[model samples]
Target: MSSDLQGDGGPDRPHAQTEGPAPGAAPTPPARRRRNSYRSLTSRLLSADAWVDTALWRAGRTIGEGMRSYDRFLRRFEVRGFSRAAAELGSDGATFGLLGLLVLLTFAQPAFEATRNADWMTTEDFAVTFLDRFGKEVGRRGIVLNDTVPLEEIPDVLVKATLATEDRRFFEHFGIDIFGTSRAMVENLRARTVVQGGSSLTQQLAKNLFLSNERTLERKVKEAFLALWLEANLSKRQILKLYLDRAYMGGGVFGVTAASEFYFRKNVRELSLAESAMLAGLYKAPTKYAPHINLPAARARANEVLTNMVQSGFMTEGQVIGARRNPAIAVDRSQDQAPDFFLDWAFDEVKKLSRRNPALARDRIVTVRTTLDPALQRQAEQSVDSVLTEFGQARRTREAALVAMVPDGSVRAMVGGRDYGKSQFNRAVDALRQPGSSFKPFVYITAFLNGYSLASVVPDAPVSIGNWSPRNYSRGYAGPITLKEALTRSINTVPVRLSIAVGRPAIIATAYKMGITHELQNTVSLPLGASDVSVIDMTASYAAFANGGLKATPYAILEVRNSAGQILYDRSRNEPEPERILPADKVGELNDILINAVENGTGRRAMVDGVAVAGKTGTTSAYRDAWFVGYTGNFVSAVWFGNDDFSPTDRVTGGTLPALAWQKLMAYAHAGIELTPMPGVDPARLKPAQVARTGDGTPAATQPRILSTRTAEVLGRIGRSLDALGQTASAGEGVAQP
Candidate 1:
């Protein structure tokens, strides 16, 4: 266009192109030039220098004009476009749209999954109900409610009980409890949590049926909206019924009706006051108040529920006491006799599985079938209670633990403490106590495994190893005794010498290989029960002896499955062969010696009337702990008696209480079952008659022949020696235990 605009006309530009049009000069007319002459045009066109100069001048002018336009556009027009767009997008309306987008995403996921609920709860992961090994419903995973009760079908007491506990102002509030939620907001702000939900029944139904259970402000806000939607659509009775049908109870149980049938093994129509109170209390923390896991806590929760019921004018105080008069139906020996202890262990395993999988069918419910014998569990509890009540009165000790397992090492029964109501600590699995002479079997087993003869005699003399000197419980040593006799009599000096001869490391290996997992001190006293171990370990180790010397791992869970019937875990599937720790021949020999201990030595109190018994007694220093670990061909069990505080008792030797407790448990456990002899030890080789029990309750030896005069003289001399040593040396106190 203009020459000044196209070219650098300022003073700073001295080398402007001379090829361009001259400033302020008119160009030649093309028509007149073309008409001048073909000859002149041809000559001018034919000159290559003239053509190149004309093209260069036009290209320079075109580029200069384009640069000026781009420079003007970048700073003036495009910058303003971006600023205007940002202002519009950052406005409140735009923010609202973004929030709406997030809400759609959050709700859309749950809504999409819900539309496909044509399948049963079984189709959900880990949502199917689990049954016991017998195929009876034990518990459920997920929201599996088989019996969907109507509002009319629900008991009045149950409705009031639930309303009193979960949401007292349910009928009063619209959807959300305004006052309650406001209070929860203030408290949560202080604690920084979704701690106190303070949700109404409708709100709970909304969250349970259609929510991710994610604890975030976005989820909470969505939950509030859904609750309001539920309130607007459904009646109050419909919402309450839905909540009752969808609530998650402990033991993977769901719904009021299913929980009624699961815990009480009865229909909702037949529920007792006590059962109703219990079901209502399960809302807050189902696992914590599960009657089987912790009866006392469950009872306490039920008591609170009953109190709520009374305060709400639903029931009287008299009715509350009467309802609680009978223990819940689950643990009633006359009714269910549930394996509460084993259930606790199995539930713990399910929890471990839940941790590995974040989305475990909401509330982490998974069907787990366990190996538990209800009959043996009952017998064990009775035996422990009877013994503690009778014998423990003097010791003033309130703690005891026991575990019983089959020859295959599947745990059948476990009692963590004397009374589960008083404590929840599982001593059988968790508590570590000195095993005392109960551990001697491992030392002798080490020797036996290494080719030491059971009949070989070891010198029983005063022993002083390093700075440690150990005296016989009763004065005067046996001088020389066979290994069988040494073990049968439980002599301290004998096992100490045997353990040292075999080497402590070998003993430790045998202990570990036999299933003793507790850390063992590498000192000389390792053989004398100086190391502490749980009753479960002792019982599991003894299973090797019962099952013909195979190393067995104690397990309670036998099968785990998801809702789709997929085998998530199976103990017997693709099972590996167990390790053979001791030869069957060696096991029989050990059995023979242990049987003799029960029949003739300190374990006499453990002898049963018709069955052959094999066991060992243990008493730690200062009577801090006592133990009896033993086994039949079919079962192995360990019992411990002591105070939780680790205080000395009234010298409650293992032989005195633990052995007696073992006898009581085995007597009932063996009833109606065919007795079998130990492997490799024929029953035909024993005496003609079974051992007898005197009126004083002391077991009579099977060997009927009277004591020989020579034996009597030897015992008489030993008595004199003991007398000379002073009464501090008790006559009946075994060498190892006392």
Candidate 2:
């Protein structure tokens, strides 16, 4: 009322026009002057008529009066009053009343343009779809979870709480409540916001079940007519049940029972008073009152609902106080069991694939082949289970996430969190965490590409740049260490010194080339992993090194064939071969250092039998997070462990949980496969030589790493670039270290 937030709901605002005066208020004109004018006009007319024909007019008036009296006398026997009208309808008046109301509403509702499809009148039968990846069913989607509870089965307190909070005069009124509407109007006027919906529960049900939510006069009028029709056709209990079953409860949830289970993990009948009130509060705005999203806001809304219930006489004041004091505990249902972490990740890709290809929709059942290897998925799951089971009790807050991809950028497995039901957030792809020392490889690799070497004597002593002094993770530094030794020890000051030497832009560019898509802050501490990134990118970047410097975009879907056996999409057919993003021989030097890191340094925990591998361990400041990124001949994997709330763990390091999990999973992934040397590395030169039964080993497990003939040419060019580095002056120019 103060401001027109309530104006026609035109693309600009969200309210309706001002409500008109109460029905039957303006019948005639203002009193005194209007009455005098009417009498003067009548008198003037009569005076003029008197001169024309007095005798003829008098005779016609007499006949007219006699006819009028006869007509009035005859009409006395017809149905004229409410009592007579009811008696005339015979028996079963409610039935006839309902029939009349339906007919009226059918005509009236359309005048307001608020009609619904026939299907809305009944329940919907939802369909389910499962996406298969690598001969395994990976994910399920599109199943509607709606179950109706009968009014009799619903708890009495819940019913009272709902009516009191939503519409107290539900049973008292025929369909609309004038007093409630008046109260809402006054409150809305006072608050200067649409603080209350002046609609009854029946009106709410009608709108929710069939109508659009555009606030306009026509919509309101249609809603009222539909409410009347519903009231006339269905019992009050039936209407209430329908409302409870169809209400939207946030996050694609619908209905009381489903919402009850979703929020509290309880049945409707078992809900406590405070729980019922909280649910009633959610009806106004589910997103605003979702306890899981914001507990305090939800509690405040529940208190307001309790006040309404007490004011409406549904509960006593004492009862309201007691309910507030003994509020029910909410469930911590953050994740689910079925889909796990990676399934949700892949399913998202499937949905996009479903949209792009027309044939995917032609069948009721669509078959999608993702790059996920079922064996690796199980290994990842088992690894997470193994580490958590062994170390979880002591540090119960810490949860683990893992992602594995082949050198060609095909994701084989991913575990987002400890439990998907408790939380669906994908930490591997969505979470942004400081990479810490895990990011050092990009700096070393950049330095190597810029003519530095694994044996480059990098200054590791503590130093200050202006007012900022960077320290190692152990708060101590080793002096004049080789770049490989610096990385192997996970030295923070050395990487920082190396970052400043190579230039932060060069380091950032190096990371970008290796598939880091997140924005990296151009700061001195960037080499110490001050910038945040997802695990998937880190894993994919390492895949570039595994595949001998080729740029690989990480992907999931392998093939999508419709039920008709017709091809819709195939990765090999649709996508072009990957291009190299780094020099092959230079990457070979970086790879040697990383492989040594795994075999002899901080990542020693990540080593497995029968293969030479490479990885790094990263422990952030204050033990906030831990990460381990490693790769083998066939696959690259990144693992992380931390609290979801970003709280510091109990001295957890990347070497402790993450490295061990990676070792177990990777060892299992290559159980029966022949040991093959990583690309860009000499098998005989690597520690404990990698020899495979197949003379021409497969670097991608099933596919060749250097597939295209053009890729071999690119490698040939990289080999020539390394040969030129020894003669160039750029190799001897030493940058000033901090």
Candidate 3:
């Protein structure tokens, strides 16, 4: 075996016999010598199996000793020595266990700072009741906050219904119900959706009382801790009472007492079982299950609540069968007919006007006497509905808004939308739409302010400002038309020419002075109504002309009074006097032009018989918005029609649906009421026997003719201004028309 090992020619052994190199021959190549050396080294390594075995065995022994030492250390310190150490530290086993619990609590007590805010408890202390011009209840908002009922006053069935649907194990559990939580988790996992919540009543109350509705682990921890504190501090009855009082029931009310009154028109103690179940259903999602909004869905939710009562053993199926069969019916408080839009606007007005009196502002419950005339409001709503029902599908129009107020700015009627329940957005007050030709009156007034009159003539040929060429509605222009005829025809080029002559800033300043609050963009299309303006603002601006150029800022609330009949705010006492914005002569000229338009031009559909009307029609690009804003001696109303998504309609112009609706509403509004002649208008001109004529014994809106010498001088200056404008456009300094 030793010879076999030695003869292997490994690197560790020498060769016994070897041949020498030939004389004068080349030595071995480096590559071939390296191969031989590698083979020898590899063979030597292959023969040393015992070395690898010894190294691994030594390593295993060292690892075993280290592991045994670790185990012994754990046994001594963790098991036996810890007990002795605790005793030395003057702590028994119970004391140490308490310390461990305290450490756990320290980690869980991070949300303790949330308890400092106690203001939420009094959030429902204010309420509002709305009335029309006459003292009849139209609607209620907020709550009768100071009228919180005690627990004993609440009907037993209502309490049981709330507990059954909200928390089945309310009395048995601590703050957090572990069994309920586990059950919820298992059920949610089974269904793959969150059908039920795990929070107890105390947890919900804790959130409503002191926390916001944020879904985070930290918030959940805070909720759990706060719930525990509530349970420890208050009795079960007190917690239940507080939850019932503070929980938000639907329709701008808080607490069951207010909800019962708002929905059933009765007290909490008078709620029947069916009504109780209905109110209980609102606790989950008040808006979703509000009976005033969707009665069928509310009944379905109430049926579910009844089922919950049965499953929770609070009542038998037979006991709940009556409620399930005869579901509750909320009081029919004219949900469809009530002036919700006007009420919403008037409520805001009340809050704003009340700020003048600190005592009035601090009052918890107040009655708002609004300026809304129910008769006119009904007519306005009907007019909008009739138009929509007739032409909505044909025109592809889905929404419309109308605002009607007196010349003095007392809002008489408003129809915000088709239905206030489905959408609370007050379109008349909130929606900003591009007024098409309806905006031309502002331009005409500006022209009058800039020394151009109704008789002043301008060429209506095709015009261009930079790359933007504003085309007329017909995509054609008439040549050399008087300003009266230009406005009467709602032509596009004349306004653009007039805008360039007078400048855009002057026009914007005139519009602002006339009560337009929205900012106007300084674009070439400003005369064409490219900027957005709200319906109310536009109507109020027109009222300036009807009011003999007086500022007619729209207002709704006439008076605000507390529950005790004490007047908190009276508009006549609190509001400032109207300021004159337009000169009487200028107002007369603009009013004459608008009246001519209604009589013989685009707004002919808006004219009411025996009443002098002045208005303008507006239609935007692609037929997106349509408007007809008109005013008589008594009232001013603005009507708009469009799709809510800003989609184009099927060629619905301002003279079509909008004008027709305005005519219907205004006709009805003027039927019984005494008609007041519009300022700057001659009632005699409205007579069929008479015709308005200029100083030359010629009709005001006769055929277009050559410009007079004085007008020629004005046109000459306008031509020079146009040349400068063209130069600016050529220099690439003009803004593109929208």
TM-scores of the candidates are 0.55, 0.55, 0.68
lDDT of 3 by residue, 1-738 (tens): 565665464434435325544556578899999999999998888767667888889999999999999998877756357767766676566788898667656755755665554644453345778876654577766544434577888999999999999998999999888999899999999999998899999999998877777788667777888899989888999899888877877665678888898799998899999999999999888878899888999999999989888998889999989988899989775544778788777767665665567767577688776777777788789889989998999999989999998888878899888877566688999899999888888888888888999999899998999999888878887889999999999999999999999998988998898878988899989899999999999989999988899999898776677877677777767778999888999998888889989999988888776678899999999999999999988889999999889999999999999998898887666654456677778778754423323222333232222222235335544764687787677778466644
- Give a tens-digit lDDT track for model 2, residues 194-269: 9888999999988886677788866777788888878887889878888887777754356777777778889887
What local lDDT score does residue 314 receive in model 3, on the 0 to 100 scale?
86
Give Cα-based local distance difference scores for all models: 0.75, 0.75, 0.82
RMSD of each: 19.5, 25.2, 19.1
On residues 1-738, what C-alpha lDDT tens digit does candidate 1 reach at each position? Answer: 556665555533647635544666577688866777876877878886677987888888788778887878765745357777786777867889889978666764554445355542233323444445433454344443434456787788888889988888898888989987788789999998766657777777777867766677666666677777778877888788878878877654568877887777888877777888888988888878877666788888888889989897877888788876774656442244445556666666565655554444343345666666655677788878877887787877677899988777878788988754335568888899999999999999888877787898889998888999776778779998999999988889988898778899999898898899989998888889999888999998988888889988887666665544455666666356898988888888888888888888889878776777788999999999989998876678999999999999898998988887788777665544556677667777443334445324655323223232235335544764666576545544674443
In what order do the candidates fall by lDDT, top score first?
Answer: 3, 2, 1
Using lDDT as the yardstick, the better of models 2 and 3 is: 3
In candidate 2, which residue pairs clash?
6-15, 334-421, 334-422, 334-423, 335-420, 335-421, 335-422, 335-423, 336-420, 336-421
Superior by TM-score: candidate 2 or candidate 3: 3
Candidate 3 lDDT: 0.82
| Model 2 segments more than 4 A misplaced | 1-133, 143-339, 353-365, 685-738
Cα misplacement distance, residue 545 of candidate 2 (Å): 1.1
